[model samples]
Target chain A: MLASLGRGRLLACAALTVLVSGCATPAFDQARALHHAGDSAAGLSVLISAQDTIPERDQLLLLLEQGTLELFDGQSSAAARQFVSAADYIDAEDRISLRDEARALVTSEATTRYTGEYAEQLLAHSHAMLGFLLSGQAESAAVEARRAGKRLREHEDTLDSATFTRALMALSFEMAGQTNDAYVSARALPAGTWPATAARLAQQLGSSDADTLAPSALNNALASARGELVLAVATGQVSTKYSSHLNNGLAWQIAFPAYRPVDAPTPALSLQLANGKTPAHERASTNINQLLRQSLDARAGALLARQSLRLSAKHNLAKELRAKDELGAQLLAIALFVSEVADTRGWYSLPARFDLYRVAVPVGADSLTATVRGKSYTVDLNALDYSRGPVLRLMKF
Target chain B: MFRSLSRSLALAAAFASLALAGCAATTRAIDPGSDIQYDAQYSFSDKNAIVKDLTDSLLNRAAYSADQAPIMVVYDVVNETSEHISTSGITDDIRIALLQSGRYRFISREQRANLKAELQEQGAAAQRVASARKLGAQFILAGSLRSIEKEQPKQWRLNRKKLVYYSLNLEMTDIQTGEIRWADKAEIARESSQPIIGW
Candidate 1:
């Protein structure tokens, strides 16, 4: 009996050590650091290699990061394929798995499959739209727009209106000649936050809002230009979630997920056109960090309730073991404490914010240079065919 | 004590064998025509139903000369749905059905580029081959696929319900006159319910 108890204690200590060490480092930390260092190709390679080693439950997170890196690397078609696979997986795993939930109650929330936050789900479609647009598949981009609109409507009651997605949807619909749908999406844009191009489009489609009817030089240039160029710039890294532990004086403690704020400055962008023309206007479109914080705030009540229940469950198990063997109870308590970790997984490759710029190009203009954070990136207009629709370019800093 | 230890080892081995057997993968074949609703998203059965309905409609309603088969070209079938569907698959099946029925003649859309390249190569080589003549298509067949999906509102419920409606619209137009000679649409609406709790 003594030898058996020793063996059991050794196994328990080993399991506890594994659980504690696993929570020491958050997922995607290395890849995110590499991406922030301006080597997105290396970051993408890390994720692609990890696909063989990571658990199947984490595949959605891997795909989201891989898709973002691929998009930044100018592999638009490959990025689109990744987003499509992610969307399909999200659809297939729509239901909550009871088995995983039960296991999570005893273990940690990390044991459950990462189904993705609502913001991530919506952004998947948004990124897919950009992917298709960048690849010159305007019709496929329109399809993604429709899908994002559906998801937005489903969560409108809880989620703040995604202004950036709505702008892209309107542009996609206009490019596809779905005038009525474009007007609808344009109308959905919040007042005072609508981009200049979206407001002009709404007004052109006969919007009754007085704000949209105001005439401006930018709108006039946009209306008269032979083609328009849309530039989207992403800057800074989003704040990461960390495990926060709360302990009482007794043998009771709980772990919850919390965000460590990141300081990301607004990027300044200036365009120098070959024809000496300037961009019509620029605006900050989406703040992903803010969205993430709001989503976590909304779930605070449920998370607290679950943590309370887990504490009670662990305490009861320990008490029952104590009635049988005091040493066993103590060992179980130590193991439970180590295993109670918070789920801090997320789509970490997303930028802190997105900014949009609209430039009107004359028929013969061939190139332009955009300077962000003192680094100039040139876009060659001669290589792109603008007769189809507006040309989109993405720059990351 | 030795006897008890041996019995314990035997029990452990049996349990391990049972767990391994449970993890083994198995495969079987099933009829393709059977309706299998795995989820609310589209499936192979939906494709078959749409193809069958649309092809039947086209074959029965097409207006053409009784003695001469209409020479046609299958153009782009645009996908306007939320899901990524290969619209070409639908058009390919329709072309096959029309040809097998002996009611329509199709100019190969996929082989056009290869044929053009082959003709260029022959011309460059100056080979003594018969002159290749390209046939002109009289009618163009084109279509679009669209879908609408709705989910049950978030509330206290044991199951979530989703409804998806898909429509495929096809038309045959006279290339010279720019007139639509035949048009038809096939629609499929399905509602699926998933349990909120399962083990």
Candidate 2:
């Protein structure tokens, strides 16, 4: 009788563990499906509803998704607010608690919270600052620029240096009429010729005493770049898969995004300027997919350990279930094997690559057409009056 | 044995049901002056410390004494930080502290719009004649809040630390001559660190 009762409790515990296996939640995929179906409003609603269920550690992922949706819908202020919330959450370091760690030991990494990768955290602030800039809040944008700079500096030794963030900071400074600060920021861009161009601009603005402002082709072309043409491309998807490897006599099952192909072709973006000159599309300074892959590789060991813990828990639970009822245990084990999923929660709406093109909007050039995959977006140069300073137009697909 | 097993089953079912039912959250009022949680990149303590330092400097100024109160007007405090912070909250704290000290008199800009409406109404009304006169501020207080963040990456898989520094500068400009009479600065610095994870 005592043995029977013991088996009964074990069965109950097994059932509970099976229920807890759904730690990553299914809302992410549901939202993604909705987004792919062109129902972004529905996708945003799904994410907002899932916010309460997502662990604090993983809440930034949901916030980033919501921000991206808002940005796509042209609600820059709302997008900025959501991204700011995500930045604060990432900075707070309040994702996992002692209770959560204990749960991971009993369950799996699905139960363990997901604090974002360093690259995602930095990108959060970049998107937030961009939203602020689009909404005409220069002071708030400046603040985000500082945060992005600090984040990038932290990852200086890594291949995660974001040159576009530096360029954005320079643009912010130039818009605020701080030519000296702008020059310093522009000089840090990844462009090989920007340093000389920046120095020339500094001298022209009377902020530097450089001897000569040479008339180089790039410098001469950039001199009249009153308006900025931002061309962003969302190419390919970031998907996670469950992988297993043998380590220390145990088969360790882990969930992570697969490595991005190094030889992936860059998507083409065609620009038709009013001056009848088309600028060739350049690759983004930092490839986001490559950066994310590198960041995950750096912490592969830790991630695998967490995944192994969850797999072990599932195994223990299945063994206990088998001891109670053989047939029930067999069915549950099969279900676990089939239903075990990877946590692929990330900002899927973010562009795989963020490309920027400078347009020398000669006076009387009223509009410019940016074509991506046969879809064209027209920018009214007059609407973004460059008399005050250079204006930014974010074109994303 | 059968009876005991039945009783245990009933108890187990009750416990499982209770566990499945999540608890309801409750709300309560908390003291505003209590020590705030140090989780945010920016916290209430940072603002509170800045306010205290700035107010202390103002109180110590030789130009204004406890006996003679100085009349001042506070324009809006500009937030130059990337994070959305309430700059007015800091100014409100300073205003409250100064008013409590009784060494400074403030002309409320919040009342200006209402005052203008009241004067116009008096002009339209035949019976009531309100004066359009207003008190001139002896000094205008305006300032900007700025922040700088620095981070030291994990070295040799040991420690990771992030340092953030904030500077609040307030200048008291004489309204009459436009000469800056007094300037005070409040600075706050914080450092947070975490142990290395992977060996």
Candidate 3:
């Protein structure tokens, strides 16, 4: 009986190991070792083998490494493929987040003293992107160009961040002889809030031209934009201490579309977006002041403006996406759409030097997701007309 | 001892009577063993190139065309050799290529796998509206590896010699239309000069 029991146990143990022989094993170290040894060939082989052995996440990491190597090895098309393969392994949310973080790093200012409090911490990032672009390697230019664009896009987003946009707004206020501690703020604006406002405007003027937008609506939008800007560009102490710019009760006016692009000669508000390669001191000369005005004019519609009422809203991208009609729907679904995001920050000039300020964060690369009747869907809220008056106006087609 | 042996025989006979079934390899006319097996190894140079080329073809085909709304096509190479090839090895390559194109984005495996799981768990509700299949990748690639065998006998003090041959066949086909859009075959042949070798 004892012998039989022992035999049975032995058989069970043997069976278990054999069954689990096909189970996953860790391969990260081996892949790393091979890759570092300059044996990309061996490293890739091990990676392929380990995809069958390692956890799914490791496989993603390996693919990321492969893409990095390909990019470094002057095979960008190959590199792009590797990145896509890695993307395939991760969730959409994670993909977007990681890519977004990477993008942020690209545009992030270096640890140099742009202000006393904010050292140019993201300088390495600037160098990295520029290195790729300047490498003079032909095969890798496409990959490098993509990186450059990411940094530029992120720089433009400073006009959207809690620190930068607010500061710019403060500059505007300061230049206009107003007291301010810059603070930028952002609140999730639900789609339900816009339709009624839009309907009211649509009612005010049955056929208002693009230039004839209502002063009341324009003021509300401007006040909101200024409020948001105050929070976006300032620093810690300044953000909390600054006086807010958010206001209400504007005089009435009409708003309509203007500057039909694709038919128009060019993007009306084209600004030289800094790709993090530009010096901080050079920023003021290149601020989106010109771009912002064009954006306002184009978005507000000349027809509304011709009526002598300024249309005050950060609706540049939103208007553009909508103008594209059916073709733009997909893009609109992904962009950030909000009347404004408001916050505040401290001003850090070089070191031991600081001041309070306020800013407004604009919606860029922002988006909206909604659930109705147990169904999940998202819309590019920024793509919607700000004055449509809150009622979830969906795709026309 | 005799009784024990007798019992074993009796049990075997009982099992035999239960219509025990089996399978076999058979042929009617031609010699069935046309396949000759051989293994080949290449230096680091060849290994690197092979993976790169194969991956490029696979990824470019999958991403640019398959994920498009209207759907377009490109060619891919398929491996049909007995080396236990996985599409992921190559498809992973394809994914990287497409993402870098700046012109295309890939449908990630995570996305596809999640869709599969969601569909399974939620049963139709999960797969509604968004589908990875929306990217129109209509073509798939495939290929095979084969070898040839030859032998020679006696030269001076040497007794015999053996040779092994290899060939790789690659093809791309329209998954929906069942058409072979393109085909190409590359072969690697080797003649081993072995002295005093026979099998």
Best by DockQ: 1
Q: Estimate each model's TM-score.
A: 0.85, 0.71, 0.19
List all candidate RMSDs to the true structure.
Answer: 6.1, 8.3, 32.1
Tell me the interface RMSD of every candidate, in Å.
8.3, 11.0, 24.7
Best by lDDT: 1
lDDT value, residue B81 of candidate 3: 26
Candidate 1 stretches greater than 4 Å from native: A1-14, A17-27, A192-219, A223-226, A274-277, A281-284, A363-366, B1-36, B110-135
Per-residue C-alpha lDDT of model 1 across residues A1-397, encoded as one tens digit per residue: 4234554764475375447435522336677778878888888888777667777668888888889989998998899888877877786687778887676776777877777777888888888888888886777888888888887877775456467777778777776656667777876777754456556666666766537355665666767766778887787778888889988754877888888876665556778878777756545377778777777776789889988887888788777767767877777777777777788888888888776666777666778888777878888888876665677888887
Candidate 2 per-residue C-alpha lDDT over A297-331 given as tens digits, one digit per residue, 9 for 90 to 100: 76678766766776777677667767767776665
Better of 1 and 3 by DockQ: 1
Give candidate 3 regions above 4 Å deviation. Answer: A1-397, B1-39, B42-47, B51-91, B94-105, B111-136, B149-165, B175-179, B192-199
Cα deviation of A279, candidate 2, in Å: 7.4
